[model samples]
Target: MRKLFSYVLSLCLLVGLFAFNGGTAEAATGLTIKDLAGRTVTFDRTPKRVVVLSPGDLHTLQALGVQVVGRPTSATPVDASLQSVPQVGNIHQPNFEKIVSLQPDVVIAGTSFLGHIQKAQSLGLKVVITSGSSVNDIKSSITLLGKLFNKAQKAKVLVGKIDSKVKKYSKTKTKVRAVILFGSGASSLVALPTSFSGDVLAKAGGENIAASFSQLKDYPGYANLSTERIIASNPDVIFIITHANHAETKKAMIKLMSTSSWRNLKAVKNKNVIFLPSELFAASPGVKITNALDHMNKELLKVRAKMKK
Candidate 1:
């Protein structure tokens, strides 16, 4: 009887040990993210100090409630909560010394700055690069950051919001023919279906007239369509996206559209020419992509309503 009792006690302890080990192993599972660039990075533990180098990425982290130690500089103000956060630098020109001083556990950079990735890695900083040039890219960035920061549920909610917005607008077809131009005057480049802004416009019910045109060799998402081609398309709505001098660009655009050939276009005759904000349309709006889509959809709906009259 004594021998049996001892054996039973030993068996119970072994089972308890196994249970504890299992729990630990389960808890030790780390997060691994594959960014838009097809590069993978793993996080064994939640990052406490992160530095985001792009406004789009910064916006995503803000939505996920992941605070950053450093943020990028933008012409417009960032989140009010992050106003006091140190500005390391922007995507084009990052201040590496300042970034290193921040001692971030990870640095989230954009794919536009490939050199930054190598420099950061050389400095022994864990880095992951992402892209937001497309709507899907925006969603992927949110999802990637969510997993990295242990905010997967929040990420899911944000992505669901975008999906819901897309679904809401998809049911109603506006039948609006539109053109999205990077600039208005001689430097204009038309956005293609492959571009992010083009995808947003398409999702919002506007048929991108430039979709069929050949994309630029260097930039597959945009094309340098001639004035004749644009006129032939005869888009019902013309949206201009300019990087600087909004007033000047608008003036030049108006002048260009007022020309004999341009004036004959349907959009010009109907006064449907519009200018989109660069901050919102030129770059990936991240969590605000839904807002961008809503704006476009509402505009298209207005156009449709007027057509009925």
Candidate 2:
């Protein structure tokens, strides 16, 4: 009888232990998701230490209130809030040593780093490769990041605000023919509508001049156009992005346009030259893009004012 009782007690204890282990496994918080490249990445828990390899990813992480443990050197001084984040190295040639030192649980990269995904994995680092070509891509990236950080609610709110802002601008039917020029001279000219900048312009009520050009490539955001082609396009509003100070770049661009056949274009003749901060217009979806839209809107309103005269 005593032996039978002991055996029953042992069986009950084993069952209880198994149930407890199962519950612990189920309670573990980290979830796994597939990235754009169809690679499965697991998050043991909300990534506390994250390394952002792309500027767009950096901006998204910053917006999510996640501390970026590492970033590339090309990252500019962001808002005062993110000034303290440390740089790991250039994204093109990431400093693996530095990255390991940071001990980031998740490394955020872009399509540009698809080849290096294995290197990250070999180092026991989980990676997420994001693709940001259009505004939709940016929205999707925000959603993925939200899930990774367990901040789905915050991501939804941020994306909603972005959508609302975009909707507010989209309601206007004012389609101004605009050209996005980076740098000076004819060779430096790049036609938009094939780039992320084009998406932003289109969303903000500007009709990109290169959208109809059959020869333009689909991506990289610009078409090499000759002065003749630019003059032929004859855009109504000329928006130039420059690294130089706003006032100086504006003067230089106006001078450059006067020297070219652009003087004959409607935009030049009407004096519709507007200069925007180059960095703000460069890349990614963030407050900079929103601010750029506001600037563009104000400039477009002036153009409207002139047209009414």
Candidate 3:
């Protein structure tokens, strides 16, 4: 009964939001959803031409096997299928003229790029923001995209797979305290409970030390790194997420470890420092959550074994 009501309510919202968008009173095939920015957005039909700006959004679309017409070439694409698509600047800078040239039916974007959303809407293009910070948000966005693209069946299978992975990797007993760090050098940031990686770490049987520090001044989903807090917390594991190429990320790690104060931390002294790719940490876990969890689980198990020994 609840499922039926949800379906009916979704259908009504789809109709209502589309109509509010000035679309045909009776859309041939459309759905309405409130975007991350709290704007009601509607699509007249399942969008065939999509312009993706965020890698997380691109990966979700890819998981649903949705073919994109445009994406940012400046960063790594979701897969080979989306690699050859037209480039729309980079993550921070979008090329409005190029995006307009594509005439995409809808632009799948992240909440971080509000400027891009405004520009696309100004040019009469429907925009949807799907940036997710936590595990639930990522899962909800996945299901929503699946519904929007009429790929409900595929979405179900994909969603099931994600759930299976989460269950398989999730830890029932957390014995290790961890702190997932992003960026490096003086600009280091700590992943809070609100961040995707932080949730993964907690679920993977590792307690996130920084989970309670949400309101860290200017940081939204992250806590401004304070050596004093970290040293006092005395985390058992320190996982660093780095960006750009492997060489660059490795170099940054070298610099991070070279810091005399950081070297004195318990995690550093015990050689529990782990480095991971930014793909799974810096962005919303998306469909790649499984991969990230698998990696963390392996490391956590090793740490547990060592501690027992």
Q: Positional deviation of 158 in candidate 1, in angstroms?
A: 1.0
The residue-by-residue lDDT of candidate 1 on 186-263, one tens digit each, is 778999999988999888988998878898987769999578888888888888888767789888888888889889
TM-score of each predicted structure versus truth: 0.87, 0.79, 0.84
Q: lDDT (CA) for every model shown?
A: 0.84, 0.72, 0.77
lDDT agreement of model 1 with the native: 0.84
Rank all candidate structures by their lDDT, best first, as comma-separated numbers: 1, 3, 2
Q: What is the C-alpha RMSD of each candidate to the true structure, in Å?
A: 4.3, 5.7, 7.8
- Model 3, C-alpha of 192: deviation from truth (Å): 0.9
lDDT of candidate 2 over 225-248, digit per residue (tens): 667767888888887777535566
Question: Cα miss at 154, model 1 (Å)?
Answer: 1.0
* Top model number, TM-score: 1
Model 2 misplaced stretches (Cα beyond 4 Å): 1-29, 214-219, 243-255
- Between candidates 1 and 2, the lDDT winner: 1
lDDT of model number 2: 0.72
